[model samples]
Target: MSEALWQPSASVELLKQRSEIISKIRHFFYQRQVMEVDTPALSQACVSDIHLHSFCTTLSGPAAPKTMPLYLQTSPEFHMKRLLAAGSGCIYQIAKAFRNEEAGRYHNPEFTMLEWYRVGYNHFALMDEMEQLLELVLGCGSCERLSYRQAFERHLGFNPLEAEHVQFMVAAKELGVADLVAKEPERDTILQLLFSLGVEPHIAQQRPCFVYHFPASQAALAKISSTDPQVAERFELYYKGIELANGFHELTDAQEQAERFANDQAYRKVNGLAEAELDQRFLAGLAAGLPACAGVALGIDRLLMLAFGQTHIQQVQSFSIERA
Candidate 1:
């Protein structure tokens, strides 16, 4: 290994900037009367989402018959929701989150995540708050809100909501990722492919972007819009082509949450992927009734990258996995 491997990825100045930004975040939340909370990083179960690879560890103690798997959280969302269910009104956390499969320019296996929930706020209101928070953290910038369908039409000239499955196949062939087509991609997967390839790189850098109203099929923990039923009241914020945050109008129904978990497990099986155990405590919290709320998980590293005008997340992190 080279000497560079032992050094921090971030410069001293960048580290200072990161510290300052975190301070600013705390003060901002403090002024808003939002309580800062800490939750355990380890859990008995992990999310079943096929795309998320949670880091797992074995836990053994005097009360345990055998070692059982405990997963490093992908986000504080589940436990945070549990708190919300327990009447911890508005709360925020800046905590370390992990995923096993990520180590890249924009992703680190272990990174800081800034997540928060606001009771009685829908996703649209949360999107407004996201824009306001980014403005506070990154200095003022114009905010632009667009529906997911609008983004698809603007970038690729098609209505993703109304498109036939074959249309995505045609696009797949044209984009030169025919292997994706051969595997028979689902609706959301195809949209994600096209969006990541064609639109994400080209999203407006002139202003912060908040894209809302995703297809219901892609709504992880979001509530489907009762008004539309075809769309989820969710949003994602992007700045300078970098995704900063994902927010949702929280899903409260235990049965529906269980169904989504089952669907994710089924999808994992079909794709030959690992199936993680569901967080039953989290679902139980839902059954106990979570307040009508909205929550967002923001990538602190990504936001730091923007603050320092660095293109890669590593520049804002003390040490990326590559260096660690």
Candidate 2:
């Protein structure tokens, strides 16, 4: 075991840089009149995504002596949506989110997230907002927009929408991605691997790029596009090949959302993963009627890295998992 002291060298210059970036982000939101909010870190329920493993703990107290399962929220999305349903227009939050089984140059189990929602806005409008936010935070004049299909075509020499499973498998092998096809035999998994390995590396480096209109199979909680039934109204922001944010056109149908969550739970059960408790409150909020809105969750640490042109996330953060 390594017993090295894990103190980080926080130079005054770098700290000042971090502060300036944070201030700029806050000012951008303030200019838009987006109300900043806070929510609980611990929750009774957690995300149902099979790919994401949340950190769970037993809550022990006089009122809860039996030790109930509490999970560190992967994102503040659900609670924020509830607030939206309650008629809070245009909200944003910069908070610490926790996830398990993530530790790397670009990842940490515990990290900061910047999430925001715009009321009565569609996915396209949100895409524009993302561009402006990037310009404001990074102090760039303009950013580029690329659809998922276009990005795949430009970088991988194939359209992601029409690619076959065999082609994706072959590409994964060429990219040296281990266990890519074995984990999930679905085409979406293969496409994701190809994007992560092949296409993502070639995105705009100096300016942020918004990749929009993802395939329907990749839509976790977003609404499917009416114009293109094959694609969902989802977009992800990438800077210099690194994914910084994921945005979605909010899905308002409670029944359909519940069905999707059930499907995710079933997938988890089949894969021998722990089941996530359903967030009945969120479902209730949806049933009560949520406005037409779009929201996004951005990686604050990754943004910091981009702002400073840092190679690794550990450079900006006070302490990483290895150091801890």
Candidate 3:
């Protein structure tokens, strides 16, 4: 191994800048009376999202006769929501999140996440707050907003909301990703490829761009739009072609949430992925009643990258996955 592996990935100057930016973020939320919170990084239940992978460990010692499996949280959404159910209103957390995924230019197995929830606010309201924070920290001016359909239409010359599976197949072929899609042949998979490969690159790089109203099938924890059942009230922020944040209008219906979890399980089984145990505590929180709110999870490393005009995520992190 290289001796340089012992060193931090980020420079001292960059680390100082990262600290200042986080301070600014905290101040921004403090001015709005959003309470900062802390949650456990480990949980007995893991996320059911098919696209996300959680790191697992076994708990031993006198806690139980047999070792119990636990998973590192990919995000702190569930724990924060439970707090909301218990009347902890307007909360935010700058916490470490772990994902058992490949590390790349924009991804690290472990990264910092800034998550916040605003009670009685919808996704659009949350987007407004997000834009304000970006303007304050990144000084990017006002952000542009576009519906998911509009983004696809403007960039790919087709409206994704109305497109058929065959159209996506044709588009994938046209975009030179047909081989990649052939392995999955799923509509959402193809759409994601088309978005990342075809559309994301074309989004505004100098400023934040919010893409809202994603297809219902892609909704992880968001509520389905009341006016349109085909779409969910979810939004994703992208800056410099990098996904920086994801927000959702909170879904409080326990039955709907349970069904979504089951759908994830079925998809995992079909895809030969491990079936994750359901987060019954979170579901119970929903069943007991959670306040109307919208919440978002933003990548702190990616935000720092944008602020410092850096390309690789490691440039803003103290250590990359390799060094960690």
In terms of TM-score, the best-performing candidate is 3
lDDT minimum window of 10 residues, candidate 1: 178-187
Better of 2 and 3 by lDDT: 3
RMSD value for candidate 2: 2.2
Tens-place lDDT digits, model 2, residues 1-324: 555444652345776888888888889999999999999998898888888888888988996988899889999999999999999999999999998976887889988899999999998898888888777778776778889999888887777788876666667777887465756677777888788878888887777788899998888889999889889999998888688999999999999999999999988888798888888898999999889999999999898888887888878877777766
TM-score of each: 0.95, 0.93, 0.97
Query: Which digits, one per residue and each the tens of the lDDT, describe model 3 over residues 1-324?
Result: 999999999999889989998999999999999999999999999999988999999999999569999999999999999999999989999999999989999999999999999999999999999999999988899999999999999888888877877777777888887778777767788788899988899897767899999999888899999999989999999988889999999899999999999999998999899999889999999999999999999999999988898999999999898898
lDDT of 2 at 311: 86
lDDT of 3 at 76: 96
Between prediction 1 and prediction 2, the one with superior TM-score is 1
Query: Could you list the CA RMSD of all candidates, in the order they appear?
Result: 1.6, 2.2, 1.2
If both were scored by TM-score, which would come out higher, candidate 1 or candidate 3? 3
Candidate 2 Cα lDDT to native: 0.86
Off by over 4 Å in 1: 61-63
The C-alpha stretches of model 2 lying farther than 4 A from their native spots are 1-6, 173-184
TM-score attained by model 1: 0.95
lDDT of each: 0.88, 0.86, 0.92
User: Which residue pairs show collisions in model 1?
Assistant: none
